[model samples]
Target: MKKEFSGRVHFVGIGGIGMSALAQHLVHCGYAVSGSDRQVNEQTEKLQKIGVKVHYGHSEQNVKGACLVVRTSAVTPDNCEVAFAQKNNIPVLLREQLLGEIFDAFKQRIAVCGTHGKTTVTAMIHHVLERCGVSHTAFIGGEYNKSNYFFGENIVVAEACEYNRSFLNLHPTICLCLNVEYDHPDCYKNFADVQKAFSALFSQSEKVILPSELQKMCDKAVLFGKNGSVQAKNVHVGRGTTFSLYSDGVFACKCRLKVCGRHNVHNALAVFAVAKLLQLPLLQVSQALAIFCGVDRRWTLHPECKFNVVCDYAHHPTEIAEAVQTALSMCKGRVFCVFQPHTYSRTKAFWQQFVTCFDGAQEVIYLPIFAAREKPQKGVSSFRLAQLARQTGLNAKYFSTFGKTAQHLSKTVKANDTILLIGAGDVNNLTKFL
Candidate 1:
């Protein structure tokens, strides 16, 4: 074991997708890992199965023997375990700090960051690299093929999140930014604040990959959109999308994806750019893109349902708009959206956009806002959002609870009609009831 990780390393919010991946990685690295969460979920169960002690609730007693404590930004300083660690003189590190340390240990590091598509793009890079027989580890923000932590060596691929500017901790050999938009209103003052953080990451990276629209942000970056060095042409969206991949106007390969949406075409193009930089064959990478099953909760389709039910992790207005439009294009019948707005701050920040993002849906049903790490604000509620949509002449309703939402869907959703359970919260839990 490394001297730095000699004792039990503790995680305060280990149930989080990002935190669990790190905790599992430490366990594989032969470190004694322990953690606590407010509730038990898949992640906590996985850790317990691997012999890592997991407490169901937080308490100061949980961090007793820890050499170092790790916590997500959401885990406030006043958290009992965090406060205890600080008072005891045990060093506490933010989740990003530990992730940065692990990233630096690898020879080739690829960090994917954006307001949207970080998880999907990171998973795509991992998928192609694995198919090409590259030995590398990946820390995906969400599960891909039932796991978030892929164990390997030499190279590391990670989803670098911009929330709280946590991604700044990473200094990557290669950094890919899908698109930059104003998000995390709780953390960033405005769009410029968001761009400055991304610009800083691009500045430190040995090689930078960005969409054509973001070219002016980083002079050294290899662009990957329309008119970019890596571009996709003739995009046809059907079962998924089929497009032509080009590098600097030179035809690279004909690509077909199993994942739906034009957003995914952009994501795959980013992967192609990264693979080209690594000197991987375009043909092999193209084949991998075709067979790549998308990450969970990212357009995850359920065949067992009476009607088409797709679950997505799109909480922002931009992402929600894209997801709804993609569903509208693919569905044979009317499309319905059951959206649960994620946080109070985000809902309030993008109030006008959210009101119109569901314009194309046959009927839009919203549940109460999922207040993550914040108390409810006075003016922001799913009810008001529904009222706004109705004012614009769209069919919209707000249900106070998941049970009521599911009950309404059961009565209204018909065969061939597509239902999108959209949000980054516990909306997926409603799937079982449906």
Candidate 2:
């Protein structure tokens, strides 16, 4: 894949954030990019506006005459485009494989991998490098105001996903692991299996960065904390929690973020760890933190109405709890939660955990589970979660509809109430409608 090579490349699942970013990258590099998704949305519209051909539904014609095809794990072998590409001898590559091929051009490839916060952390490192006018390329999961794309290939930051061991495809110079936990039960059978994938990811890096808590899943990885080698200290959890970065042996300067949560401090620290690895000045990393407005929909503030409408992608119980507590701390009033549980298997597996995660909220509104890849389970529904919520002594209500729930939230929440729309799926979009 030369910089001048512009081949007939088509993406099978093109509208997703990751796939669309890849297509956009190819277009920037002069490749003729075409893609097919099951549905049309903003990302497809953005691609079309940028001169990339995109179709609403997948078809064999979409893959025909293409020199190469890019597919995702969600794209099954039976997908018409994938099957057609395979049958016609067209080279088909997965998203991760394509990333590995693209980053081969960079002198220093930095990968951020973790069960959580990889997107924020990767964007953070990219931000610091970009702000200093260091030419770098980045492929993160979210569009954080934190950074932009590369200029002269000084650094290339990529979010290493752990799904199906996808991160393994990329041999990174620097890797991160943010508390690996049991997830993707459909992909991995149990907790040990998830840890094994993470352990393998940790072992491959030239030098790894991890929080002190997950040191058990790893050893000898670069340690970071409020007082670790590459980290922030004196993190006063005032109104919104302020902190400063520390490099090899010097405390750079104090910095504050518009974003909330101790997790974000950890997120920023991961970036600081990589910056130190590259010998970037600690002051540059601290300045980037102040400029970060936060990733889209990751606690994007909505201070328009009486109550602030915070949107986040906290589908997992642990993520939800963290987001809720963060929101609660910021709100002088009460924290109202409008949560849509994601995936049927997740809802069923962690049914009891969801009930208790709302402890930080003043009230809880449960929406139907967003069955991403799983068929809906008969018994495992948001209704069951609402039942459990009641048993936990929280003011809970189950709404099978997002519209009704949003309306309810608008009417019920008092002035200065903080409500977070938490989920991985379309639930966050409701905040926009509000």
Candidate 3:
């Protein structure tokens, strides 16, 4: 397909995973790409290596001579580059708007959307499609193995995040909604608001893949779950989940995965449904899923030390509860959780749920909230969360710094104990020290 946009494209906050993936795809599609980020990171460096001019700091000068400026949701209206683009009459697009334009170029575009597991499910679908020799492109949410964006032909598989109703911007041929819960308190008022946004996205999709649990949400959807159109039966959960997939009440194939958790089984089920819908060989799809190691931070285990460390990008209450439960299920020893709340709004919004999410952990270490795109709220803090957890009969402790947290863990964590670093923030940085 011909590239949609011509001339130079500048991305504001290009260091973000989603923004960088779009920039990478645009560069691959033959657009002259230049971007500026607040700080240089691996993503920015990768962009520079791939010939995208990456400026270290945001400035009006960064967007000079650019035909279009793409700004991430985190980028504010007063951001220098965004303001300059508007003032100078350069076309400005939101991150999702550009993604929607890119989606238009593909005939078999699959968008995986959910409050959780979007990254894993999108990456899984991409892997299966690639293994089946289906030419495809994917814009993954997390850095899976090495690259987040894979350039190919025909099909495009991408993670559709629901935050700020961004996924609604995409009109995919195939859409998968793993599950939904109330999240992104800043953008969504409640669960009903979240469901309304997803309902809009589902309505626009040509074919929707959803869980049987959410069958009531969409009437004409290809559902996957215990009682869905595509079902996983005889499931066995261990170091990873192994199950048999049945398509339309008929036995299809048995599959195994290296990625742990029952949640992952549902994620793989969505991928299987996509494969079946696309008419890919079931055996090949199962093979690809079995060998799939997982995205970068989704139950990523480091086994070099006495106590193994598992890192995950699970920040929401449901995700946190699942991560802790999954770690408990796989580990033979005690499961310790080092959790860093992602944002102040989320922490404040889900405070009660967050307190109960750490039920399965043997000991919980609470790190300060990351506060990515929001300023800290007056009464919302990790210390308060820890206090709540302690009140609920949890062995919880709060540490102000990662170094002190690591020190405490080193002293307390015994051999064979599994430390699960859980969050979407820099809590993963503590893994290196451990």
Candidate number of the best TM-score: 1
lDDT of model number 2: 0.79
Per-residue lDDT of candidate 3, residues 111-154 (tens digit):
99988899999889888888888888999988876989999988
Off by over 4 Å in 1: 1-3
How do the candidates rank by lDDT, highest first?
1, 3, 2
Q: Comparing 1 and 2 by lDDT, which wins?
A: 1
RMSD of 2: 2.3
lDDT of 1: 0.91
Winner by lDDT between candidate 3 and candidate 2: 3
Descending-TM-score candidate ranking: 1, 3, 2
Q: TM-scores, in order shown?
A: 0.98, 0.93, 0.97
Residue 397's lDDT within candidate 1 is 94
Provide backbone clash counts, one per model. Answer: 0, 1, 0
* TM-score attained by model 1: 0.98
What lDDT score is found at residue 180 in candidate 1?
98
**Of 1 and 3, the candidate ranking higher by TM-score:** 1
